[model samples]
Target: MSQLISIPESYESLNLTHINIAHHPPQSPTATPIVILRLNRPDKNNAFTPQMGESLEQAYRLFHLDARVKVIVLTGAGRMFCAGSDLDIGFDDRVERAGDFRDTGGRVALAMHRCSKPTIAALQGSAVGVGMTMTLPAAIRICHEKSKYGFVFTRRGLTIESCASFFLPRLIGMSKAMALITTGGVYPGLSKYFGELFTEVLAEGTAVLPRALEIAREMAENVSPLASYMSRALMWQGPTSPEGAHLLESKVFHHMAGQSDYKEGVNSFLEKRKANFLCDPYEMSPGDYPWWSEVDIRVGPKASKSKL
Candidate 1:
C-alpha cells in the first residue's frame, strides 16, 4: 500500500502567488510528489527583476525546508519561460548598493545547486541570459522541441554571471561554453545533443508544463520521501571532499543563523503564519573587491613615440 502523506491545510490557504512565485500550479496531483513554481510576469516575457530573483530564491528555500515537498518543477508563464533580464526597466538602483550583480545570481545559483531536492526546469519558449543560467543548477530539464535557448551576455556588453563561468563549461564542455558565451547565439536541438543538460525533449507543442507536473506528481507519490531526501543530500555532497563539503556547509549554516529569515522561517512554522522574510541574504554584499586590475590600454607604447 502506498503511504499517504497529507499536505498541510495551511498550504492550501497560503498565498500561492508568493510561494508559486509565478501564480501557476498543476491542475491535479500526479504520480510523483511535485511542487510547481511558475514565473508570473508573462507580460514582460517573464523577465526577472530583482524582486523576482529574490522570490525565486525564497520559493526554493521554502521547498527545501518543507518536509513534504520532494521535487520541484520550475517553469515560466506565457509564451516564453523567460526572456532574461528586463533591460526596459533600467538598472536597479539596488545593483549599485549590492556591489556585484553577479553575486546575487551566484548566491541563488549556489542555493539551487546545493539544495537537497531535485529540480527540473520545463522550458517551452525562450530562455535567455540569466534564464539560461538559472536552468544550469537544475538536475534535469525538459524542453519543447521548438523552445530556444541562448546565452545573450556578450550582446549586452557583459560577461556571464550566476557562476555560469564555472558550471556551464563543466556541463557543456569548455569549447561549447565559449562558443555560446562569445557569439551570443541561440542553440536549437540543445536538448537532443546534450541530454544531460535536458533529460528529455518533448514533441513540438507538447505542453511542457503539464509534463513537468506529471513527473513531479509521480515522484511525490512513488518515491520514499526519506530515501529521496537522503539520496539528494548524498548527490549534493558526493562531489566534494568531506572537509570541503563540511566547510561549505558551515558557511551556509553560519550565514543562515545570522539572518532574520532563519528565525522567521522557524517562527512562522510554529505559529502557523506566513513567513514574511525581512532580509534577502541572497543579495551581494558590497565588501567584495574585484581581483583583476583595470588595464590602461593607452599606457602601451605608442607607434612613433620611441623614434627619437
Candidate 2:
C-alpha cells in the first residue's frame, strides 16, 4: 500500500531516505497493524551513519504519534544487521561544542525508548558497537545463533554510547555488562555472557526476522496498546521507594478506572470476547502522567520538509 519499501506519503515530511518503512498486512483498514523499519544500506554492510540515526529518530517519533501502529520491527537489509559506525566519516568531526552536542546514537536510543509502541529488533547477522547499543532500547531482540555482537567501544578508545550504560547492565546484569565492556570482544548471539539480551536466538540466520515478525504480529493482535505502554513506562520510570511506588500505582489504578478501555476490558472479559481497546493512552494521561521531569533529553530530530 505504501509502495513497498518506500516511505509512505504521510511520512514524506520526515525525509526518511536512509531507512525503508513498510506496513505489515499492506492494507490501511486493518485491526492488526505493524510497521517495519529496515536499515537500507546493505551494500555497506548496513553501517550506522548520522543520516540513518536521524531517519530512525524520525520514524520512532512518528510511531509514538500514530495510535494505529501496534508494534515496530527494526532490522537491517541483506545479511548484516549493522557493522557499527561508518568509520570513514568519524564522529569526532562535529563542530558543535562538546557540552552542547549530543551523540546521534544516544538521541536515536532515547527516541526509541520514548516511543509507546512495543518494539522488536531482528538481528539476522552480526552487530557491533553502535548497532548493538542502539538495539538495547528495544523491548525484545531476536537474533541468529551464529550472529556476533560486540560492545567494541574499548577497542576504539571510546566509552559506551546510545544510553547503553543505563540499559546494558539492567538487561544482562553488572557482571556480564562489565565483562563485555572490558573485553570489547565479539561473541556469538547465544553467548552465556549476554544473559537475556536476545529474547530468542534461532539456529538459522534467516529465521531471526521471521521469529521477530511472529512475535510482533502476536503482540499487535492481542495486547491492549494503552495497558502495554503504561506497564513498560512504569517499570522504567517508577519511583525508587516502595511507598512512592505504591502511591503511584494507586494513582494509576484510579486514573485507568475512569477510562473507556477499563470498562471495555472488563466487559470483554466477562463476556468472553476480544476486547477492542481504542483509547489513546497519551490523550488520556493522568494529571501526574510524567511524574518525573525530563531535563535536557531530546525526544526527536527535526523533520526535513524536503522530499527524499
Best by lDDT: 2
Clashing residue pairs in all predictions, respectively, total 12, 0
For 1-308, candidate 1 gives per-residue lDDT tens digits of 95543434233333543224322243433222366677788878888776677767666665555554567788887888888888876435454333333344665677687555677788877788888888888877888777788888899897787779877887877777777888887766454334356777777634787788778766654444433443444444433577866654455446456656567668878998665544422241112211124333232333565658
Taking all chains together, the TM-score of candidate 1 against the true structure is: 0.65
Query: Would you list the C-alpha lDDT of every candidate in the order shown?
Result: 0.64, 0.85
Say which candidate scores most in TM-score: 2
- Report how far residue 11 has shifted in candidate 1, in Å: 4.8
Question: Runs in model 2 with CA error above 4 Å?
Answer: 1-15, 27-32, 298-308
* Model 2 residue 262 distance off true place after TM-score fit, in angstroms: 2.0
TM-score of each: 0.65, 0.89
